[model samples]
Target: MDVAELTGTYTYRSFLNRPEPVDDFNKLRFAQLELRLTAEPDGTVSGELVFSEGEPGGDTIGMDMVGRASGASPFAFTLTGKGRPGSPVADFHYEYDGVILRHWDIGIGQLMTLAGTVLRAEDHGSGATLARAGQTASFLAVKRQA
Candidate 1:
């Protein structure tokens, strides 16, 4: 598929992979995410991601992402926190590796989906390093209509 096909807004959902005894603190973090992406002619993609709890009057966070797309199935991207210095998420960084999946949705007809694994590349809050990252999650993002 053309990289341009990925330029749009999408609703994203992710589930963290915790150990057997999952506790309240180890549950999924964000309630929802909105991804607004723009694909360039050079196969590079830049975008903004907004994360919300899906609750009335709840707070939301925004981050910036940059990555490259391939004509084949593979795509990789990294998300960097846009928070101020010393903030909880100031040093947050995540890397996502995924593939574009095309399928038919009963309600939306043909649907384009992004399915992947997310790695906690950097997490200052947890003092995570390359050898001992914080956590991993699986994510799925579906492009929204114009």
Candidate 2:
């Protein structure tokens, strides 16, 4: 797929590890993730990622990101966060290495899916105390329809 195809707003979800199995008592809970992507002619991709609700009483976070398509790989790209210094998220940055997936879902119909791994390259705010830097998580995101 062309890089432009990946440009749009997407709803995203991530799992700390693999998700837990679902059962009668275990209902799935998901954070709200909004990814807005735009691609340039040179294959550079720019976007914003808004993440919320993963932790109890945690504040929603938004970060700006920039990256380019992986060499000769139209389906792949690596994006890094660009948090401003002194901001709430300034100390922490995330890097997402992802690829577009073409799949059909019975419930969601034809889907423009982006799946990959995300890395917390730096720790931010109070989280820095936890030393969570260099941690990685798997994520799945679907482009929203216009």
Candidate 3:
């Protein structure tokens, strides 16, 4: 997949693992994410996922995360992330394998531009799905605040 294809801002609600409670997935609500993906000729993607405390208009109370994905295609890729959640004591990092499956047939395929599902971090029994109408819904394009 090309960077321009996925070139846009996206909002997402992630279930953060509460390290103090043995890595439990807690509902991180009203959180927004901005992803800028650049496709490299080597079939790898370099990007940054910025996590904000509230909407873009609000103050950034949390940390900003950065990660990279490498794969033959964007549908199925591996991502590794590391960042601090606005705290000096806590650290955030994880690796996940994601695949874009057909919504009807469930067959592996290239992720659809502007519309698709991404399964990230499946360690918690089931991976999180970031898609339309989900708890985490992000605009694929950059939002220009007025």
Most lDDT-accurate candidate: 2
Candidate 3 or 2, higher lDDT: 2
True lDDT of residue 87, candidate 1: 38
Which TM-score value belongs to model 1?
0.69
Give per-residue CA lDDT, model 1, range 11-34, as digits (tens): 988886655665674376533688
Candidate 2 clash pair list: none
Quality of model 2 by C-alpha lDDT: 0.73
Better of 1 and 3 by TM-score: 1
Q: After the best TM-score superposition of candidate 1, give how far the Cα of residue 95 lies from its true spot, in angstroms.
A: 0.6
Question: What's the lDDT for all of these models?
Answer: 0.68, 0.73, 0.40
Consecutive 10-residue window with the lowest summed lDDT within model 2 = 23-32
Q: Tell me each candidate's TM-score.
A: 0.69, 0.74, 0.40
- The alpha-carbon lDDT assigned to residue 37 of candidate 3 equals 54
- Residues 1-146 of candidate 2 have per-residue lDDT tens digits of 55677689899887666456666422433245798889876789998887543357764457788998743544788899766554565676888998887554554577788888888887655644664677777888888899
Can you tell me which runs of candidate 3 are displaced by over 4 Å?
1-4, 15-32, 53-74, 84-90, 100-146
Best by TM-score: 2
